[model samples]
Target: MKAKFLLPILIAALALGAVQAWAQAAVGAPAPSFTLTDTKGAAHALADFAGKPVVLEWTNPECPFVKKHYGAKNMQALQAKYVAQGAVWLSVCSSAPGKQGHYPADEWNRILAEQGSAATALLLDPDGQVGLAYGAKTTPHLFVIDAAGTLVYDGAIDDNPSTDSADIPGARAYVAEALDAVLAGAPVPVAQTKPYGCSVKY
Candidate 1:
């Protein structure tokens, strides 16, 4: 009887730990502010981008899901288009040190250069603090903040979350649609959707 009672207690404790491990911010709330070092060692504060639109993308270089967007130049095209429209796109990697996608400043620079990415900064979140605070779920998880620092949109990059490049053309492109709405001073039709991709290796 003692063993049976102990089992239920242990299971409850484990469940609590799981919930704590999956910390994330809520939608329709002010985005959590953070200061992280960019690839060049420059400090970037989330609040600094106040009064301007900002895009926060959680990324993992080795994730095949991320490769799907970069390999097809879909992510870069979005960055280029939005940056031109006065948006600051910050790609953040929260992979821990020695992890599959973790990289130091120099390696990050080379990777970005080779990929021809257009993000304003490649923010490093080696400790996973920022990722957890934002509740980033997967590589390519996207968040859009308005000029007022309110989280306007958060979810998958597009409707299709598969690894096949062929799906790109048919995908609904959620991020693109949200951005277009924001640029036009309209509310995002889909504020949040179930994000699907490789789990962020934190």
Candidate 2:
């Protein structure tokens, strides 16, 4: 009887996991559309950027892995580089109201200013709807959407998953590689990889 009960629970859990995976925008598939409010109380929608490439970054200011990239200026540099090239780079935060990374609008703006963030906008996703749609599971999870609204990449920021800023110099930036390929009309070399960082607070 115990074995029978355990099997059913296992099956249910697997089904849920599968559903979550399917809900995410798959590589080569149309990027899932979303509308989110920024810290400035302005609402932005994916469709607002119809003909431009978009970069989605899952960020939490308090996560150590996030700090590793930011402290190295690695993430900020990418934001500046890509956004200057006419891509929409959006930083997303999905931490719940009482969660570790959650912060009010004023504090959020202050932090972004201090970090010199260059993303087009810092979108708030406190309800986790956008994160869940993208299957964002890590503090530094990343996604790249082509100009045609196709999701070309979904995974870690770089090849190395270390929390050391020193790793930034040596690590291959998967997001940058994919965007470069997309812009050049070439196939993305590495499409996906398991993300590594603190679990997203949902």
Candidate 3:
């Protein structure tokens, strides 16, 4: 009986440790490399984009915080601008199947088309491995990896952090600022910030 009880406790502790281990990606350091499949079932690896700046956007289409940016075209505009300059913008959804924000591939493709999304790919993270590894806590948690593969920025997209589209007009777009500074050979003014939005449904 004692051995049986100890086994359960040990399992729980190991699980917690695994989560902590996966969340070690830090700013100014090499971002964790990952391989995830896009909606079309094509696998892409972070290492494949080496020598180019990359943006990892954690998104939940049904989240109001995400809607605030997309509805205002702020996110797409950012994607378009940076991608035009050779940056790879990846939109990742960590919602598990049967969850609130989860959608099938057909629905995901349709949603992208309907929303005029400009992301290079819609990565499906149904198991949430990518999100957990990045320590993404919010629906719109954003990360920017420079050409050197260093995570130059990680956090909220903007300072407003509200679910209102009107807030975009005056908010400090952190992701854009980071991208500009990194691309210009300057250090990012803000390397990290507490992200705000709906919790990523793992």
Candidate 4:
């Protein structure tokens, strides 16, 4: 009888944990606040970007899905376009220490330069705390925060989930749409979608 009772209790606890995890950075909710160091050693906080649109990009330099965008210059173009329009684009690396994408600041700086990244900052989260808080599940996952700090969008970069750069031309660019809507003070047509890519190396 004790074993049966304990099993149910354990199962309920697990279910509750799952729900809590899923709730982080939920769409329409206030994006979770965090401060992280950039490749240049400058720290950035969500609050600092208040009154401006913010884009949080979960990234792994070694991920093929990420490579698909970078290699094709699609991601850089998006960064340049939005950054030019006054949006703050933050590319975050959540890969843990010793992981495939984890790199020291100097190396990260080199990599970003080599890739021609145009992000406002490349924040590092090697311990994965920020990633967990945002429930980031994939290297290429993306989230958009409106000026009001609400999480307006979360999911894959585009409608196409494949690793083919050719697919990008035909796929709907979800992040761009979200940024446009936010900048225009309009509602996001699609707020959320299933994210695809290599699992975040936590």
Candidate 5:
């Protein structure tokens, strides 16, 4: 009887895991579209950026790993550097309501301004629809979509995983590198990597 019970439980667990795995977006596939409200209360839709290279930054203000990048201006500098070249940088907050990083829209903007964030928009994803669609797992998960709406890159912000600003200088910036390759019509050397940081509050 115990063996029979365990068999059913194992089957159920495997089925659940399969569902979750299927929910994740596959690289090289067309990115899933989303319409999210920005920190300014303006609605921003992924479809609006169809013909431009877009960067989606899954972030949380309270994550120490995220703080390491913003506190050191590493993330902001990257945003400024690329936005000047016509890239649209969209910062996404997928923290669920009552979670560690959950905050009101106004508060989100306040924090971004205080940090001098260089993103074009601060998008709110409190319901986690967008996060789930992209299979974002961490506070600083990064994704890049090319002008054709194809997901060109999905993974960590850089090679360094430590919560140390000192490591930023030596880290291989995955997003920047991927964007450069796409712009130059070259294949992305590292299309994906294990994303490291706090688990997204969702």
Candidate 6:
């Protein structure tokens, strides 16, 4: 009888823990803080970009959804446009070792260079701690933090959820909109949406 009661109690506790973990980075809340190493072997803390709008892009090069954006130079263009305006664009990879998107620092540098990435930094999160803290669920999941360090947006890169670059031109770009709102000191039109992409390989 005691064992039967304990089973349900344990399950409830586990479910509650998961909910709490995800709630840590909910939109409109303070963004979760993290320190991660970039491809250049330098550490970057979320606090380092205080007072500046920050863009967190959870990416995996092997994911077709990511390829759709990069192949069309859409992601890079967004990075350039915002970074030039004082926003920090960080492309984060949370794939674990031996996973599809996992790469050594040097390799990552090469990949970014070859792809013409304009992100301020390519942060590596092999342990997935940062990803988990931010509730990153997909390869191209995106989060936008305002100058005040409040998580203003969390969702997909755009409204379309396809692997075709051609659809990009017509889809509503959510990340860009969020950045614009944050930079202009306005509320994001859409604070959250269902992100679509490959499951984060944690």
Quote the positional error of residue 137 for candidate 1 in Å: 1.1
TM-score of each: 0.89, 0.90, 0.90, 0.92, 0.90, 0.92
For candidate 1, report its TM-score. Answer: 0.89
lDDT of 1 by residue, 129-181 (tens): 78877778899899998887888898999999799878999999889888898
Q: 112-155 in candidate 5: lDDT tens per residue? A: 99999999999998877788778888979999999889898999
The models' CA-based lDDT, in order, is 0.86, 0.88, 0.89, 0.91, 0.87, 0.91
RMSD (Å) of each candidate, 1 decimal: 6.1, 5.4, 4.9, 5.5, 5.8, 5.2
Instruction: Give the 10-residue window scoring lowest on summed lDDT in candidate 3.
Output: 1-10
Model 2: CA > 4 A from native? 1-22
Model 1 weakest 10-residue run by lDDT: 1-10
Alpha-carbon RMSD, candidate 3:
4.9
What is the clash count for each candidate, in the order shown?
1, 0, 0, 0, 0, 0
- Candidate 6: lDDT over CA atoms? 0.91
lDDT of 4 at 14: 79
Better of 1 and 6 by lDDT: 6
Per-residue lDDT over 1-202 for candidate 2, one digit per residue giving the tens place of the 0 to 100 score:
1222533554686877843342457988999999999999999999998788899999998899999999988899999998888899999998978998889988999999999999999999988778877878899999999899999999999999899998888999899998898878799999988889999997
- Clashes by residue pair, model 4: none
